[model samples]
Target chain A: MGQVVLKGINKFYDSVHAVKDVNLQIRDKEFVVFVGPSGCGKTTTLRMIAGLEAISSGDISIDGSVVNGLAPMDRDIAMVFQNYALYPHMSVYDNMAFGLKMRKFTRPEIDRRVRDAADILGIGELLKRKPRQLSGGQRQRVALGRAIVRHPRVFLFDEPLSNLDAKLRVQMRVELKKLHLRLGTTAIYVTHDQVEAMTLGDRVVVMKDGVVQQVGEPLELYNRPANKFVAGFIGSPTMNFATVTVTEANGSLIAENAGLRIRLPDGTARRLRGHIGHKVTLGVRPEDLTVAGAADPDHPCFDAVIEVVEQLGSEILLDMKVGQDVMVASVEPTVRVNVRDKLRLAMRPSSLHVFDVKTEEAI
Target chain B: MIEGAIWRKWAFFYLPMALFLLFLLFPFYWMVITSVRPDGELYRPWNSVNYNPFWTWNPTWDHVRYLFEETLFAAWLWNTMFIALVSTAISLVCGVFAGYALSRLNFPFAGSLGTGIFITYLVPQTLLFIPLAEIIRNYRLGDTPWSLILTYPTFLIPFCTWLMMGYFKAVPKELEECARIDGASRWQAMLYIVIPVAIPGILSAGIFAFTLSWNEFIYALVFLSSPEQKTVPVGVTSELIRGDVFFWGPLMAGALLGSIPVAIAYSFFVEHYVAGLTGSVKG
Candidate 1:
């Protein structure tokens, strides 16, 4: 196992800079995930670390040795591509053993490694079958097994579960987390799925437009996003945003939107002292808003009409319209509601996020 | 109405296909008939009065026997096989490497190199034979099978290289990339992954090179002045025509025999050949 340190890594394709000035330290035995939308250079960063792509400008060191000039083979890294890329002509056993054999390992040693990986992946019966004969999930395991048998210093996975069905993807995600724990090797995974990052990574790096927005533990990023992009990208049923102007109403900081007013919590108000007169964007997650009676004196509240409601057995997603903007609220599944029905909602100030309107930075 | 409509749909599908089959089969039938008939029946218009299309009174094996006995049929066959085999082997070796490079490498002006190879293929052998003949004579390779084997690749390599280039490109790049990461170098990857994956393309390209060298007439006719060194096409056509009195019997007989290997090769890998052609056209 080895730690990877990327210093001032920048990649450019002609005039278009793909990854810009990236510096990160991934500890040994740490699972770090790079998450972003397509073309955000997450995959490019992973590929550069794997030595598959050359760095236009930067230095990459693995276990305290510079590896920018090393070929992929010389770098001693294994990668699992999105398409799996298993050899179609070879059986699962041969596909997994190819890298070991290429490195001149003995036959008995290769067989032992192959059997161990297959047993770990639960694909012992598939050893004799060619890749083409296997299903997508089986091929994915074989691809993973191929990388495992190499026992490289680092494991690079580029959306390895993106091609599987939804249920299989979830199952594989759990398996991958367990596998990382078992191997205790440094793993750098790249994906656009935020849930995967939250579930798998010891540290998650959120990126946008080739720039790292924030890097932190999953809950750290979730609770304290560095910017607007990180805030919106880190959660599903995404955080809701509303334009509001902060005004001091009789000494209490009041955030006023059209047909809505929320009195800021004292701690949140102190953090926004410098931006009292400017327009700010108030952010709240779906699960942070609750259905409360109009006379509930716990926290600030709002009134909204339900536009749509989706019940997912245990929880419900309420699409409610307040004035002009629509926001989702997560509540108990048994909270019976209908379209166009007005309801009172209590907001939790601790869970609320505020960002500067012009800079999109957290305030 | 339902039965008639079903019949109409069946005919709509199979009618064009049946016509295509007959269109292709007619020429082979014509060649076989002409080869078997006597010299007198070479160009006789169909006789309606006798009403005999399948049956010919003077059907004989005279032409076939005369071809063996009169000319250097055996020597020409041997020379053609030798040149075709050598040319095909050399072309494949040169073409596969060039093709892989053109498909995968990102060197300076790689696109222009591919276009340069195809442009070389476009230069007709008939147009090139004069200068090539002079060069061959200067090198003292006149009337030698090596002349054809060496010159055949000038025509064969460019086209075969282009064919295999598109074939290799059609193979998923990730296959080789995965192998490269599996500790195989460029040459090892080509040997273990790219080549095996492109077997069908190479086989079709090989068949093309062989048939081209076999049927080539212009360069063979111009360069080979001796009957002993001439390939099948030049030897058969030149030997069977004596001062405008064409030896129709042995000429058609040799023509028939000369086409056998090409025909068998065509049948052996027809699927791959068609796929190769389609791939090249797209690329």
Candidate 2:
């Protein structure tokens, strides 16, 4: 039973507080991912949980026992590093068998485990080759094999697939998910890629500036971000944000700017009831903004001129100008649009997001 | 690999290479020729007819024979080899540990401490031998193999440590971190992952340390006074020359023979040495 918990864990590097007061509880057989921009403390938090980095305060417990002062070896975990970290001098078999050898496994047991892992990774025939002789994907597989051979209680991955090319990254991501399911071991993955975190994680933790912003399932974080940072960080083509003032008129709410006005839906207006006459940050995802038609006169429509048209085969993304700001809108491929042409775009009322400008928190 | 024309190849690659080789190897050629030239030809004055100083005729082993039989050249060679190897071993052991610590561990003052160790390496050996001589005499290790062996690391360790620190820094820290999470202790991770990956760096450092102690002159001259204890550099210069009379033949023979070990060492690990110098730990 692999269960890892971090209680108010903090890491300080001299005067710089790198990871500040992180608390998490990873359940048995759960796949959790920590994702953030560069220097956002995701990797630092992963290293702290792996016991590679010391916690300046608080405790980390693995399997209900506090491992704060324990060595990484005593923690019973295996990690796949971003560079794979395959032992260059050792053969693939030796690299896979190293942990077993360290634990004093018998020759037969070590052989069995190594061969099983190699077969599982489809690298059985490449066991005799050194790490330098293997391709990048093969090295990645061998790295994975090395971690699996130990059968440790917890597996830590620090941007393992970020080294692979695009197509290979997707293939390996699927394989990693399958491997986790087959092994049924608790795994903690860290990456800067939102797509990787969304696809691979059972639960995703989004961090920014050394603080945990939000943690939830992929769709939850995408559909309901906790703050402006989470809204922008967890989606592709990213959510477009604009500062609009909430003004009460005609017994309803109208979010207004210089060249844009949208009537806030009743549900959204209720949340902004006390914040009238104050400015709020309006967030709209690219896919949530659709082309308005004459029949949609009741919808909140705004005028925008298409600046750049990007046809991505499956969908067409329009970079359009609204007042002084540019926002991207993902539309159906069948919709005909061109640069410098004016269009009326309507935002999905139920999907609209409003954040307090001061706190940048969802209103 | 120079492209375009044949003239460009010769101008850019071959001709310059040939000249550089000649410039580099001329000293060894002179050493080899002078050691073998007969005494009649050796002092034959450059003004003599049929001079041809570059080529020698009627070669003899008399200089080599005298170098071995008359002077304590064999004992000096043995002494030089023993002192160099022992001191290099001691320095490498300490250096590898010190270098790994300075580069990898996040101890207090690690940055300044590394700079401190490197600063010590920059101090000229000429100045260090005086204070060292006093310590050698107080400990009564003077004129013995231990005198040079123990004192050589004083300079060698810092040199080795500095070289190794730069090398260790190039090795990815992820390798050790991965190994530690694989259930290996910190020491095991270093042994299994870091040191093995750093073999080329270690060889280059060892080669550098070996050559430094092998060719060290001032310390050997000041510390060792006996013909039996004197290394090749000190013994050959002091014993082969007497006042105004310079034994050119034996002196050249000693020079030629003394450099063979270092040459062999360089050629033996040339690939790893180059890799070490260039920082081969890419992964």
Candidate 3:
């Protein structure tokens, strides 16, 4: 019963339009993530859904009821902040029970819910300890426990795992996914880390400059990005892009520049036919580029010189120079490569991406 | 602690520390010694035989006895305590709310309002007392404990407000936001989350306000002219000394006794006061 719908959501701070028109429909029990760089309006959109920020001109409804004028307390939602936001003076049990008490729950009911949440969070033994006495991970668990005790209709998270160390962040991300599955509550999470969005979200929304760029399942975004920003933002090593002029040769389109040349695959060539003799941006992921082999003769290949090699244990990342442009390639760890080595790299023909240079949109 | 050598540690840390301590404690040492010294030794010429101004051979409680039994010193002590406590309580309540609003609430001119309050504190009390005296006479609160008690907050509220505003700003706004999202109203969030977290700041503000009102002099002297209504600072200075003849023993004893309460207050909350100034919230 937690279906949330937003229509034409916008937020303005004086003259600055912080969040532009955004419309989304979140299914019940679904986990959605909003991700972008700083000031990209992801957090602002979440806050608007939570009723913490006033929408400039829009309608937000939870469970099929408009909540535009409702206060946060009446929104029937819970939030986990980045800093945990535990009450410093209260014990863990009291912290978990505060919401229940405010809602006028009976004494025994409050106790039962508090203890149940503590057990679920594996913090039953820490009920009497204050927040300052707990470690960071333990405090984070208490924050989650506090949110779960109320059994709110929705859960909002604003960069909740950003404060943890790298290892802890990964562990917490798994726990968060498990928690969402068990609770079956609608959750909206906002973060700047694409990896977190990819791992935890059923669907991820990509935004830039206060505008929604793309919205779909995580794999859809990785497989088919709508624009140049999405392709570069979703992957770890990032997609390499080069501006090349589209020229027709032998009834096939060729994208060539001072640094490299590539034959556009059949599907991309058909869409890019009208742009011949005009400059178009070519994009390819690092994993899609590899050392050329005999089987890759039909694929587009180019010459490059290795500039730097980074050993990542599982794989090696080679920063190579192709004429004036620099590109990176992820190859097998056993491959022996060094700086200034001349190499031939091949791109998977089916994986090549081309974009209109002016619009920066996929072609 | 200097890292390398023992002499570097001593030269850089211990030597300077000892000298600083001696320089700071010299006045208190003089007060304590003079309060207990015999009147014969206190007024004697420094050039006389067996005249050691630094140390006294025989100590007496006569000066202390004179302070308590002969004059209106006990009434002055009671007046000062009552006035300081009442004024501090009034100032703290107003200061905490004012500070929270000025720091947390987004309103028109909030920044300038905070600065304006601080500017009032910077106005010297020396210049303020004259206009205040005229107001006090018109209100007919002159020559009573109410005069000092009411006037002290004129300075105390601004100081307490400015200190508390800085302290409230240091507390994370996320705590209150989380509380609100967790089903608490704005007032409830402030009471349960913000006020408890701001206890150290409140205590530091209370301690400073109490100390300021306790030692306040110009207002006490101008508003309270009667001998019985005067506070410790006014009574000890005007009553203990006659023209060209300073009562050294009784005067020093009164000074020594007057400072004990403030000293005790500082030591009692020294840890919290330092933490308040440093603005440490774990989150």
Candidate 4:
């Protein structure tokens, strides 16, 4: 019953077009996350769905009913803001009961729901404490409790975990996933944190500059990003990009730059045949590049001078210079590496991504 | 607070703080002493036998009795309280709504309208009262409590509205939005979420409005002539002084008694008042 669909949604604030022609279909009990950098219109789209921001054009339908001009109260959705937005004057019990009271529920029913939500959030002991008296994580739980007491059709979260400390954010993230699983409510979450987006969403929507770059499941996006921006934004330590001219040699494509030359993978070369003799952007994730062993001649290997080695315990990240371009390679922690050392790095053939320079789209 | 040597702390903080406290409290001390001093001692020459100007050995309550029993001081106190309360209530209702609208709502000419209201406040009462006097006379409310009650909001509304607008702006708009999405209409959201969160601001504004109207002098002097209809500032000054003869003891007594309510109000809500001025809304 919680199917939400947005059709050609657009938003404009005076002369600036904030969101442009976004179309999305969210299934019942689906967790969809919209993720992008700041000013990418992700939060704006979430607000539009919550009915807090009016859409300039197109329609939004919740459970097959068009809700263009409907008030937020009529839309039957709840939003948890990044700052928690807890009513400071109210105790936790009252804060959770406010939504039920506003809807004219019986006092006993409201109390039952409030207590139920508090128990679910493990905050029953804090029922009488005001929001200011609680810690940030507790206040966040109260915000969630407030949203859950109403049993709204869809839940909108606008970076709800951004305010918590790192450990608390990870903990709350797991709790949020568990909560969504238990409630099975269709939820639309917005955040600029890619890790949160990947871990929590059933389908992640990547956006940039008010445009939807790609929408797919987490692994699909990681394996095959639709564009250069998605490829660069979805992974941590960011994907390394280098501009290289493509040339045909013996019916195979070779990507060459001023400092290094590498053969394109067979699958990538087939699609990039038309891009021969044209300069294209080559993208490779940090994890895909490792120290080249003597037996790794079949893979595309390049010489790079290590500039900095960051030991992150699990792996060592080597910041290296390949000609004029700088790239990062995540090597095994056991491998000995030092700054100013010359290392040969080989990238997995199937992991190479080539994008058209003009369109910034994968070729 | 100054952190370093004792001499630096004394020079930079303690000395200045002591001077400020003395300067601020000196007037209240003078008022209290003059109100309780006997007439014989108050008017004594500086060269009199064992003359002491600062300390009065013979303190009396006769001036307080004279003020309460002989003059219309009680009536004036009642009149001022009624007018200040009524006017503050009216202006608070109007100010809260107006401030919320101006700060939160998107409307045509909202910016210019706010500026216009502020400009109205900027017009000093010394000059604006001339036209206000005409309006009062035309409405036939002259020399009545209604006259002051109605006219006080002329300035009080703008003051309250301005203070309230800044307060409402400091409140995060997401609270109301979340309330709206949680099954409350806009008005409900404002009433349940916004207004409650803004209690500190409202209290500070209420205290300021009450003080302004209570101590108001020019409008009370020009509009209220009868001793029974006057407020404290006007009634005390007008009734206690005779032609070429000032009744200093009873005058000081009336002033001292008249200021007690405002003092009590400030002390009662001083914490909230300071918080409102600082304007911090923590989540």
Q: What is the per-residue lDDT of model 3 for residues B1-283, given as tens digits with 9 covering 90 to 100?
A: 4799999999999999999999999999999999999998988888999889889879999899999998788998899999999999999999999999999999999999999999999999999999999999999999989998888998999999999999999999888988898888888999999988998899899999999999999999889988999899999999998887888888899989989989999999999998888887766
Task: List, residue by residue over A1-363, the lDDT tens digit for candidate 4.
Answer: 799999999999999999999999999999999999999999999999988899999999999999989999999898899999998888999889988988999999999999999999999999999988999999999999999999989999999999999999999999999999999999999999999999999999999988899999999999899999999999989999999999999888899998879988888889888888899999999999989995368899999999999999999999999999999999899999889999999999999988889899988
Ranking by TM-score: 4, 3, 2, 1
Q: Whose DockQ is higher: candidate 2's or candidate 4's?
A: 4
Which is the leading candidate under lDDT? 4
- Judged by lDDT against the true structure, how good is candidate 2? 0.92
Better of 2 and 4 by lDDT: 4
**Residue-level lDDT tens digits of model 1 in B185-207:** 87888899788778778989999
How far does residue B233 in candidate 2 sit from its true spot (Å)?
Answer: 2.0
- DockQ of all predictions against the true structure, Cα-based: 0.46, 0.70, 0.74, 0.86
Question: What are the per-residue Cα lDDT tens digits for candidate 1 across A72-169?
Answer: 88888889999898876678999999999999999999999999999999999999998878998999999999999989999999999999999999
Q: The CA-based lDDT of model 3 is what?
A: 0.92
lDDT of each residue in A1-363, candidate 2, tens digit only: 899998998889889899888888999999999999999999999888888888899899999999999888888999999999888889999999988988889999999999999888999999999999999999999999999998988999999999899999999999999999899999999999999999999999999888999989999999999999999998989999989999999999999998789898888999999989999999999999889994356678899999999999999999999997889999999999889999999888888988879898887
- Model 1 clash pairs? none
The C-alpha TM-scores of every prediction are 0.95, 0.95, 0.97, 0.98
Local distance difference test scores for all models: 0.88, 0.92, 0.92, 0.93
Q: In candidate 1, which residue ranges exceed 4 Å CA deviation?
A: A294-296, B1-6, B9-11, B39-54, B57-59, B271-283
* Model 1 docking grade: acceptable
Tell me, per candidate, how large a share of the native contacts it keeps: 0.49, 0.73, 0.76, 0.86
